[model samples]
Target: MSAATPTAPWTRTRLRTSPGTATALFLLVLLTACLAAAFPRAVDRYEDRGLRRTLAAEAPARLTVDVTVEDPGLELTPEQRTVRVSDPVTHAAYRKIAASLKAPLTADPHESSYGTRSAEPMPALDRWLPRIDGPPTQLTLNAQGGLADHARITSGRLPHGDYTARTMEAAVTRDTARHLRLAPGKVVHFPDLDGRPISVRITGVVDPVRPSGAYWSTAPLLRTPEQRSTESQPPTHYWTAALLLNPKAAAAILYTTGRAQSYWQLAPTTDTLTARQLPDVTRSLASIANGPGLLSVRTATASDTADVGSHLGDVLDRYTELRSGITPVVSVAAYGTGAVACVVLLMAGGLAADRRRAELALLRSRGASLRGIGGRLLAETAVVALPAGALGLLLALAAVPYGRVLPPVLAATAVVLLACATLPLRAMAAHRRPHPHGAA
Candidate 1:
């Protein structure tokens, strides 16, 4: 038999004799494959972190779905006179509408606020000191849900939900209490459009834990009273604030005011949101804003006139735009790393081919075909390259547990293919050249 006929044994013997070169080649392949697999995974992890950071930094108002419905207190009657809808029916309808609107959201509602407030401000007067005059103040009766969770009671206690009481139980913010010189146990009378006055007893003074948080964004005036001046002969400087009441008292406020503005809000929980879900969230918001999602909500609620609005869609759109701008940069970096790895692999393959030149020439003298020589080289290289590449990929996965699978898999495959192809191609190229020494 010819010396080169047992190619597998020769390849094994060559690797055993050149252990140092084989080890170096194996380490090189491992390092390059590791880098190739790690780059894209690292990018994916960074994107997810960035998305979470963006969501956390956003204002509550910018990330909440808000719906407003105005009850004009005028229902057309068959008797040609205006009739009012019962307070209980109106309150129940508002609750139903809010639930329907929030059903399609993927993120849990961090704060689901639904309430009613007087559309027009009413003149506020001190019940005890009726004759004594103070700065002109107006108040809008507001009954919002989940108030106790977001606020700390500084004095007295939270308002009781006593719909039967002649005087409505209410609370005021620290700012409003300070500005208006009001406190607990104080009774304030707000004159209604009808001759009778709506009496409210101050039960507690509250300080908002996060005045600028999403919860307070639902009712901004409650945190900071608005100061307005009219263009009258003697310019009137008046302050307007909302009086906090138990959610159960919403019906009474609607009854007293006759007409009021109601709001329903769904604030998304940012902590649970991930980069992978961003596209789906954006599409969902878009559907709610102008697509079939909005129509479905409207149909479910049976209220076409309800004003549905949100800044969440705009916020997500901006995030998508920012992500798109960053992707190309990351891709370029990954490609540059791969290019460098390929160059280094080629150099390593060339060195190995040079060391085996004498053996290759001897094989040629034994009448070994180029294909047979190339196949032996390929088999030897794959033994080292495939396992190294696989180990590198495993290391990358361990490092970034949250990364995508396909990108890293593709990266590792590319590295292994290049490493396995390099040595055979180099050996074939070197032997194809005409030699000055005619030993073969």
Candidate 2:
């Protein structure tokens, strides 16, 4: 009988012989630690804009756009000074633009009422009138900031229809109504800028916003000295009471007042817009800006601006930036560390396994089955990898925010197993167990 060959312990014996193999496993754990350290910051930067859960939940943002006064010198009609964006011509133009872009547009616009306040006081009743400063102002609610949609009416019904110049009804804020002691169904008289008598019956009251509970202005009702030119003298004008009217009514008021005294609000149809579509929107609005009697429109809307529209390039740009943003140095460090670790593990494992070919050959000669040898080697790999994975996880927790844990540990284990498993295959492939005397 051939001499009984001792069974080479696949795991313990292999490790005892090749201590250097641990270096590859240690390097994998170190790389995993590096990934863990950088992961939180990377994720945080991504979440800022890439996936906006907040925006999805909130209503679409609206922008305020001030219609710049073109002929501050000429006493032009509001219809003349400002293009009626809600009119058929402008609406059709926007529709064409929308159709061309294949985008949904919210046609609702907030056209401001441009009439002057009725300077004449109410008929004397008692001494129950609240003290009010500044001139009374008339303003119309356009598509963007309509009374029925945004405001809460504390009393009475809101004025119906597209605020026609003919609908002699008006909605006042709670503060304005309280100040004038005006109630629903009360007829109020006011003079247009041309001193034309305009009588509008109070229809409802809008709830004031917040702790002050005061409705100051339908829009900014203050006029400073600089707003005046040689044509517009007595520059300082104040608006104490604001009347909210629809576009048609506002146009009527504007016609009576003979001035474009307010801004237009603009917004896209959808709640959100993408960066790719901004250029088309900007161009579409450019057509309107070039229309008759309208001044050049601004490309970007500011926070204070009343309209958010014409394709929402600014908002889209912000979201795009968030999605694409990367941590400049950390991104490279984390990825590079992982790739290098993989390469190192594979090379070191192969070398260590090559050295253990003799041990595998000895096991084979001892009648140890291939399945048994593979099992032992695989178990040995798990033993090293599992502990290294745990250690890597601990290191990661200490280094980075606690938001992450499992990914690094799992990654470390996977890397170690891959490296260790590859070793056995390379060793088996290269090994040649010499046939014993008289054995095939």
Query: Which structure among the candidates has the greatest TM-score?
Result: 1
Candidate 1 residue-wise lDDT, 231-330, digit = tens:
8767667777788988766666654644567666767666656677776776767776677767765554345766678888787777889999988987
What local distance difference test score does each model get? 0.73, 0.47
What's the C-alpha lDDT at position 209 in model 2?
44
Q: Whole-model lDDT for model 2 versus the true structure?
A: 0.47
RMSD of 1: 5.0
Show model 2 residue runs off by greater than 4 Å.
1-45, 49-146, 161-167, 175-195, 208-237, 240-242, 246-254, 258-326, 336-355, 359-440
Leading candidate by lDDT? 1
Q: Give me the overall lDDT of model 1.
A: 0.73
Q: What is the C-alpha RMSD of each candidate to the true structure, in Å?
A: 5.0, 11.0
Pick out the ten consecutive residues of candidate 1 with the lowest summed lDDT. Answer: 78-87
- TM-score, prediction 1: 0.80
